[model samples]
Target: MRALGGLWDTTRGMTVLRDAGYTPNEKHVRRTYRRLAEAGLLTKVQDRPVQYRVESGAV
Candidate 1:
């Protein structure tokens, strides 16, 4: 989520994707993030509001 300065929650991430001309569904977005976290590309850094951090050097 470089558009979000590398840390983002679902709502903001979806907005960024929309701004970039992608109309991704919410479930798809969440699933993608889940996959990224599973793949070690992202880290779940917050619970409330559900924020995540990009792994170091992941950009």
Candidate 2:
């Protein structure tokens, strides 16, 4: 996300939001990734932890 910019896993993304006081849960994180990826706004890395990176300039 804009917080760190480039390559991050679910844990990292959740951590970033938590650190910012968003209180987003695991399901929320997964939903975000799923929605974005489904919308073609995110690219899911076929890794163990299932990382996702948002496509910049995407709606």
Would you list the C-alpha lDDT of every candidate in the order shown?
A: 0.82, 0.79
Tens-digit per-residue lDDT, 18-50, candidate 2: 898998888888888888789887788767788
Q: What are the per-model numbers of colliding residue pairs?
A: 0, 0
TM-scores for every candidate against the unseen true structure: 0.79, 0.73
Tens digits of per-residue lDDT for model 1, 1-59: 64346677788778978998999887888888889999888899988878788887676
* Local error of candidate 2 at residue 28 (angstroms): 1.2
RMSD of 1: 1.8
Cand. 2 Cα-lDDT: 0.79
Error of 2 at 54 (Å): 2.3
Q: What is the C-alpha RMSD of each candidate to the true structure, in Å?
A: 1.8, 2.0
